[model samples]
Target: DLDGDGDCEILYGSSDGKVYVMDHLGQELSGWPQSSKADLQGRYGFVVSPSVGDIDGDGALEIVCGTLAGHLYAWELDGSVISGFPQYVGRSAKSVCAVVDIDDADDAAEIIVHGGKSELWAMKGNGTALSGYPLELGGDEDEFDSWIFASSPIVLDLELDGSLQIAVGSTSGEVYVFNTDGSVVDGWPVATGDWVYSTVTPVDLDGDYEPEIVVASADGKVHAWNAAGEVVAGFPVTLDAPVYGSVAAADMTGDGANELVVASSSGAVYMINKDGNFMSGWPTSPSATTFASPIIIDVNNDGALDVVLGAQNSALQAWSRNGELILSQVHEAGDWIDGTAVASDIDKDGLVELVFGAYDGKVYVIDLDTPATDANLAWPAFRGDRVRGADAVSTDSDQDELPDAFEMAQFNGLEQSGADDFDLDGVSNANEWIAGTNAASASDFFSVQLSYLPGEPSASRRVRLTWNGVAGRCYTSWQCGQLDEGEEWELADPESGTIDCESTGEMSHEFDVSADDCFFRISVTR
Candidate 1:
């Protein structure tokens, strides 16, 4: 399930104190055989999704699960249960999950979960309790509050930190984040409006590896948050009332851009894409009572994104990535209906399958027979001219060897990581030439070319480029690649029609690097 392996491993915990593992087909891999017999398993159901990872580096991914019985279970891939349960620092039973090397060390990521009387807890890998004791993030200060944990915590690298951090949302309309060291990075009490019941989905729509947070608020509005927790862009729904039901974010378009799918209390489904402006163009929406979140799947096996919604008391609705309704499903034990749906290649056949939880306490598996997704495609957030809400730079801002994607913006088409340094020396070509040191001519160290971009209209009143002649040689070299900042010029290339040298003050000379890009004016040191 980790990497589209198409293996539907049963990642569930029983109150019986045992963690059970089965392939996507529901065959017993029996991860922790003895776990079934653990007295610590408690005699109830483990409602939380199984947190799977190999904390001991034994090459086997283990299960770290919590039970309503107030115990934490660590089950191994080979069906071997850890001897003792890690202390649940929280005062009450809640949810739990484990991440890998959160601190960037050989040690696995620490474990943390919420619930149980408004509290949070953190622990080191190998069951070592954190030194500062269990840390509580957001709990309903109001006891017996309608709910404590709105949804399972979503994890992403918010700080662009290689290490992943956890984002937890509360029924009180709060969003909180914490580092692996049990430190709170930022906490906002007004994150979402009342009843922001849905989990904050993290997706990088614009091809940025960093994911953006999307939350559905009871205010009947959906708000998109940047990594800093600022509300970037959002849309309000008129139907299904204002109570935000649930929200999911993903790139349904093979174009690398992501679309947002939101389910409302009125059972209405909505879809939107980040197209220059916020575009709400979902070709599909079921007017059923759909409170659960919709998951992105390749159901038709068309290799395109599909939408699947677990309806409330209604049949499950499946739509192709393009919004073509395909399936209307009914479950045998449909109670509250679909609780949560996440996609995975549980079968490990290179195709992703939909894995969702039902209020009936049973997990449903649906095969999405589509071809493996092309991970290389840019997500909605990673593409286009705008980000979150403002104008977005390209991933490669500088076209230098060092990409602008590292800067997380665009300078032309280069990404910070893929920015090209025309000088091949680290300085951006724009930076080198902007100061007007003449990036076009190398030896002169004082000449640069002014270029008109591709396809600029000449009807806007043409202006001619002019430069004084050099003191000596007519063909002296220019461009030092070390121009000061904020310098600019415009020159026309007679050959490319970019610069009509035939006009007055237009210097005429054969261009050394012409045709690829247009030129306006050339700086002459003489």
Candidate 2:
């Protein structure tokens, strides 16, 4: 497409370690070359993926590609090598990702790529890595074993524990889940009928706003698992044939529910709904086997989705949202297509284009160039945002019976649900709650250096501090001023402090505050 025109073009990179610039007709531009002049390498025997991000923050774009040679390369638009080019990943980085901050503190957005075996590494764009080496999900002490590691991991927001998790499928047919903080949650594994070959894809399969992961196994089955890793049904339903490519997720049937698009070695494309219900329609098989994956786009501005897939026969096909045969481009001159990827907005005209990788080690970009309108070129509908496990799930959005952190996340950042009670002083709010004389109103009750508490026996009471919200959170613990490496400020897990739960609502405990103004939070669970 002419950049000055409203039309668009596709841009892609390939397996031979070269990048391609193409015209709308899948025709090479006069100045285009099949291989990059940069002499970059990422040959992992056969694995590669190129990611697009404005690394230099320049208006122009950049490339971050991984290779079977276990190296990651970053290149600028001028075809010159960037300072961060060619970083090691132990051996072959199968996948690369940008870290989504789970703490929600707006930390730096570094790139995270997976090395072969069980290693996960976090690195800066310049390839400067954090202190720790790549960490393994399952240590040698863990009894669990993956059937064997072959599947590329799919990142998902499971655990709903605030952050998104890395969902990995092992050849052993076991699905392993880790917290966004990179720690193991509960141990529950899904036994796919066969080895998992594709990356894990998660969508709100049930449309409850919660997402479910779709894992395609080599045993010719696509299994669905919930956040807990339990097989939703007797999954492992047979697909048309054994799977090698990744399973695609998007609203394919035009229904509100998301559909699973599976591409097979037999070159068949099948669509199944959330319930694993297959559509009555199955498109005819293409002339060549499809090891390359499938992608979705709304090609005709119908507000519906279109399907696109690649084949080793050097064919790239696109189906209309309603399954109508629309566009096909075959490059007789190029090597067999090995991997396919799509990106939108190269021209920023609101429409995205198509890109694919070939065995010739060159990337190809072509204009999706369909009659897609702005309505048809919709971005991902699911824009998930929320990260932090400082508190358990906030069941009472109204700030009722939970901790201040629970209430903090919901309301403008404070709830007097009374979940935190560090002092056991009948009050369980936050640092905002403190009453030197009375322990009941932690929120409204600010602290006063207690000159005295009555030498004689005094009644136990709760001290409540007041913040704008009904509760307060985060306090510098006076009992344990500064925490050491292993120190934690916790009352008692099972014990409810010196006060008895059976003592009725009037029960309270008296604990001395610091001579200086110290911070603390209190909650009333009982």
Candidate 3:
């Protein structure tokens, strides 16, 4: 999906010291068996999942990730290194990142990282930092700050301007907002009682076209704050336990008004109405703790968003709005889950799939049993758009080298791959372009017919050759004597020598045969 090649690829780093890109069916793409480690020159290992963005605006997406060696890298879909990447950003505890168009000053976007140093750094797509970056948030220089590990920058247009704004929460229990130029917003960092590990999730509860920031803190409460740094009327909504995972907003009951969904470290799920009151049939217990953010999608296709997440109990579960368990999938006997989960239509098959990483060193994609009728903004927090609610979809609907209309006529249909041989000919659809033959018909191969005319005893033999010539293809005829005589084939003379045929028509060539039992073979080379 990152490449917009009309297919979704599962991208992740593994213990094998490599970055793996697999197709929707778990098949690895070519040129990607060990893309990352090899590109890094074996300098560091990758532990976190990679993010995707078309940083160069080249109509193709690039995958970005950080290494344990304190460096960040951007890779092309074909597994090639992006120029000026693998930037050495110093030591980092967890370098989770997102791409944003902080300012439309370049052809690409900036790579924003919440480094282990308890600071946020913004770099141009080419690996150079902006003028005033590495913004410090005044946190003690602790190696394991929960905020550094959990708090990621969210890009949104808080002022409803055409440009983007950045919102980040810190270990100091304060949420900070900044203009794209790195200047602080008016009412300053809003404070909470404890650490703010949850990334900010913006929801416009009052339908004002302006979104209110909803953030969960380790203080066992979910708080909503306006852009002006004032808490919403309902104040901080209390949870049964410490709220580590971020909350998701969706109208679960189809009531037009959205509900706040939060999960705690104590293995419980709570749904709070817009007014900050708990919903009926209350907290569903799945018996597993999760730090991974909860995703809201209609798992039952009942027009209400369902809850989906992986848990410490080694299971990925989905629950209905009414707190009924709909799907439960398990990993190996007792392995735990490691990262956050994202849901999207990755396969382009019109169905959504759930994606997440695991402690056992693997990335998983679980195709939901239900078909997705539309694209989901389920990835609305970390890597979502800087202004738009969701990431932009690649405009290239057909990934074939041939444009959509041309491929449709050439292959006589859609969704064609280079690997398919539609004409049942030995040549694949891609290879057919070499001879400019009809890919839909097996009878139209590049072939040559040879004919010989013997003259008087003193005269040389005349060999006439004819073929349906193709444009841009070079035709050659070779002659050899005695099939088993070890006679080497020599280039035969064509009437037109080498032709760059301008159209599809009969072409003729003549060569004089000198040796007995001479055989000729005609070949075309592009």
Candidate 4:
């Protein structure tokens, strides 16, 4: 867009030889819908997207794109082609060029254009070639297996040095990391077995502060390389289908260790750990195909990062860090998405919205306000704590009221809640505790009885309540005049109470019945 006006314009190039500048509403700019028809009318077309940057430091970004005729052009916001542009570099420059400060001069950003089977070129803002000119980053020319630089160039600091390096992939399955002078790194140009159409991502997968290169090759594998160009341990993990989307890294498991996330042509999204193992509940298939790189964010404000990506099925989906699908929305009817769906709080709202471009010549802005599921809910809680007990499910040998995992924790696996009474007391195992009785002893049971002590000199009908009292527990005896009216039970004042721990763990209380008919109950509280 010409300015950050809260709405962005689409700077798109088409095979019809046109460069249209349209807003989010799909309306063309005043003098836009420009074209390269005059230069190569029926000869070539545009296959690469226009790269935007402030080439002249004019505060306004300019649009740059390469035509199928190998001509690169930069245009102003008003569709005026920047003079001295449309420079012919090679046969074609189809891959998206990265606008970066490759020379580190800080004067202006240089354009890294892919020369499609020719060479990788670095051009100044005014269309002049850099000092090193173009470098042979792909296959050799005039060869049967000459490779094409079909992937975009990524600029990052590989060695954590002050200077940045350029990482790009070729159709010949070679991954090259080049210094700013267009020179290859020490052990670079690593070769995979297949083509690489996805952009390379440099991330600190092991939290070493030094970035590692991660690339998704068309041979259905994801490879990671350290700064020295050595394959990272357990890398090049195989997937089901060819992966065309760029790889992303984040602490998906909240382990402080980053996981490599990549999508494939078969619509599968994989979250591989640093040790190259598939995370539990991963390789999720959100759509039939996912070609765009996945974007990682804490969409639900979750401490763990989540994933957001576009699918070829015209839908945008978001997944939890544990690989559970959280939310999804179909954005287009028939147009499949081709670009990464950017996530941000576009409306200043807490929830982020997803924005992306599609194959139907339209851009989409989808709202993603769905509340994030508790990360543990995506898996399971072993004993109530979310972080641990990941394997509690299988370790639960007894499928009863309480899992065997926490059995040893609460009790010695003796306080079972089943029907069997362990103390030989009349109260069952479940009822013994509530009745203030010892499940290990028959004499320590809670009892309420009515007795007529006619043999005593002062005979009176008495209601007796007896129960074993714990030191910190208070037991209240309640009585109702009649149970027919569903009357409330009132606390009963005991005539006497006694504790005898010598013979058994026993305590007792007695209450004289004042009414002819009475119901009694005991309530325990700690």
Candidate 5:
């Protein structure tokens, strides 16, 4: 939860252009119901879901979401707008934004989202566009055949190379896989023969370590493709209706193999085994129509996974792994639940709770008797996790202190040593990593400056020390009577143990000048 109180807080965006945060008891948190209409200076609301993560390296989480008017906003836990946010991307942002560490140099995450039409944007946590991004998917904007991206993008290490690859679908019926550099991966942009509205789900079906891509389309088919982009045998399984939402995978049968859970717009929920065959007692209809993806969890503490999904009939339904309806578990909402539901042990209690938002501008948190451990079930929530729409894989392949993605982006490979100063900057790569500064830019190194306030009581003059700081990085200001070699450096403000940099900018600390000659310095800490 935002306050680290152990009870999960429900965060959601409504059609009225407001974002809200509420406690588990359904009480609205203070400084919430943030209005996008006022923030963006227009009438707009969220059509896609909101994602939460520490956009900055700060330990505190920030809410990231886009509006139908095409502005992307980032807010602090208290509903305060982050500096450099409400970035205008395009005409509309209809897909969920994926917050991930695409760049590992600073340990900060990037916000990846479809900027409507042919644009795909990669924005840094500071709300600035990442270089080489906002890549045009369909080429020239004037082309009449340009594709529109509606499906949310997923990030994964498809090749198990420690670097993430982005996979997303378009209205042109094609699924694209791209390297972090924005180059299309070989054997990708594969045609699906119909519009793809579902985000690609990655599952290691053959125990190959690398995940296989599984996605459904308006063609009424579920297509499976290996890492090589070749269609898996048993082929595109045809269904009775088109799939509009994403597919969820989990070990529903406890056979150590994942079962694909699909909820179609026709209100049917089907479970297909890894063999591309439908499970027994399949195709259970929970409601008349459903645009929400199903989540697999043990809702009744029955030792077996249950499929949970919301429907246009304003009801949340649950069914056993074998497709039998959980008769006593239906929960109705005031309006349609078009978005996917997330499960967690919200109240720090042993039981898990299902949380989702509805068209009536209300968020519901339904408690269940299931064990809290069920929250860790494989693919328990939408997009495989509760924080983001996709998973970001980061690793140090060569045992270096720097991440593989950082080395690859800066040196084209892992050829540079973390102990060396790559750009001839005074700071080593390791220190640069800690300071979240650019190792390749000498001018970007961290340092501090001291200055005296313009006006203050002559008896105890005030002095301020400012430093270039990174968000989430802790710093300590020190002072010493003299610059002697053995002089001890004590905390400038002992009462305040450490200073937390809330944002990447000038971080300063002020204190009354000492009665005698003193020296001041700033040191960066973890």
Candidate 6:
């Protein structure tokens, strides 16, 4: 998936402090198996799953993960570390990171994570901390003992408003909802009366259009709260065992209403209705224990959704919508399956594959026999999607590397050609898309300026070149000694190769003036 080669490539970090990318045939990708110990001095290795997205607005996805050593790292697809990364968060980062577009104006998304004990960290794509972030919690003694531990954060429009909010749980038994600006949503930080290790799942349990925030506690209770932080009418439902994984939702009965799916530590899976009652054939156990979250999909190509889950017993279970076990579809693994499964048509072969990581140090990709359908089912994957963004997957109908959603939103259709300039701004539609510049405005293209450095010695005269750039994009400069026709151009700084932008701002570089007739030009390398 990282190379867009039609076959899905698996990305995972191991206990040995190495992150790897493997193709579908299990061959390692070039420049992979990047070691955190060598790269960031990471001693504790990666304890949480990695998140992928185009964090830098450079049109290519970047992988982001936090080590248990409390250092967050970002790497390009080619195994190179992003500049200014390996940012220290706190004592440790036990939670999964969420990469999302918290601010629409920025185009580049933000990385949100619970930085160990009592701080929620938010950083821009360029590895710089977002303003008013790394928000501290648990200030009052009566509030709680500790804040977020292993629970991942979710970004969604909880109020049914246009703006998104961050929702996460604390080990102290409270669910906090914060606006993009780090301000607490009115009436949030609701008490669940027990420790919460599960990520908050948003589902419209009552057909109200507004999703109800659902979460389970370690004390074997499920709680659903409305937008106003009020408990749902049916109230908290008690389960037989402690819940360690997040709850999932889907229309299991094809009744058009979502049923909450909960997997307990004892491996008991329950389907609960909105009325706080268990559905028929309830509490089915697939294995001895389970700490991984469950996902819903049409595994048999049936119109009704099916349950797919992983367990500590090294088994991946598939159950029908009516609670019947699909014995033939069950897959056994080499070790404990503690990570939630994600489904995607990675091969583009009209069928989806279920992917997950196991304690045996292997990432498994299971091909489901079901044909690919519109993945509109509730809670189809961990934290909602492969990137853990809690948003619908963006499609690229024209396969131009530009998402259809983005193209439609920005240009009204797919009529714009990737290699052609839409606004006659000297930049192609593709480059404009990568730079996050306006495609219809001729004045909004990438621009560069040249000037002489003020403090340079006359004998070593230097010229400074500054250009507006997007973070993570590589820019290369070319120079020609003469302006005559067919004159050869060479790299302005041959030893530097390409310059990687560290932030979406004016980036400057100085070159020793080689000739009075030198002409220079800057272009994006990637």
The candidate that achieves the highest lDDT relative to the unseen native structure: 5
Deviation from native of the Cα of residue 320 in model 4, angstroms: 2.4
Question: TM-scores across all candidates?
Answer: 0.62, 0.59, 0.67, 0.64, 0.71, 0.71
Tell me the lDDT of model 2 at 90: 50
Please report how far candidate 4 places residue 334 from its true position, in Å: 2.6
- The local distance difference test score of each candidate is 0.49, 0.50, 0.66, 0.64, 0.76, 0.75
Residues 1-526, candidate 5: write the lDDT tens digits.
7887777777777778888888889888888978885334454878776777678988777888887777889998888999999988776676788777787767677899976665779988888888888877662231321322368887777765456788888776788888888988999888887888788888767533247899999878898999779998775888888888888887776555667889878988999988899999898854678778899888888777888889988988889988998988888999998888888877878778888888887777887877766233445566766332223442343446665435533554456777989988778987776777777788888888889888855666678898887875899888877988898888888887699988778778988767563688877764
- Please provide, for model 1 over 1-526, each residue's C-alpha lDDT reduced to its tens digit, 9 standing for 90 to 100: 4323544455655444545666666666633334422224233446455676656665555567765544566665565566556455333344445344444556455566565545555555567765664556454542332443344555555644235566666655676766657677763444555644555566555454345666667667666666666665543333345533446555555454567776676666667665323344453444656556666555566555556666666356666554556753333346555444555454557765656655565667766555444331112211121121111112221223222332222222223232335434545445433322333234423334443334454443233333533222132222222244754432333345333222223253443333322323343311
Instruction: Give candidate 3's error at residue 260 in angstroms.
Output: 1.4
Question: Cα RMSD (Å) per model?
Answer: 12.4, 12.5, 20.2, 22.6, 17.9, 17.0
Off by over 4 Å in 2: 1-12, 19-47, 53-62, 75-85, 96-107, 126-133, 137-155, 159-162, 187-189, 300-303, 320-335, 341-345, 348-352, 360-526
- Predicted structure 2, TM vs. truth: 0.59
Worst 10 residues of 5 by lDDT: 139-148
Give the residue spans of candidate 3 off by over 4 A: 15-17, 33-47, 93-95, 142-148, 327-334, 375-526
Minimal lDDT window, size 10, model 1: 381-390
In terms of lDDT, model 5 sits at 0.76
Candidate ranking (TM-score, best to worst) = 5, 6, 3, 4, 1, 2
lDDT of 2 by residue, 425-507 (tens): 55444332222222233333433232234444334323333222112122221233354577555542223343323321222
**Residue-level lDDT tens digits of model 4 in 1-526:** 3656665555667767887777656678877887774343344567556777667766667788887767888887778888779888676676776766567566466888777655788888788888886888655332332332267776665653345677788876799888889888899989998877777766667653346778889889999888889999999899999987778765566555667888888888999988788999898964677667777766555555677777777776768877787754435535777666655444544454556777776666666663322331221110111111011111122323332222322233423654666666566654554443555567766665444434333433565565555553456777777887768876666443223233334566666655443677776542
Q: Report the lDDT of model 6 for residue 121.
A: 90
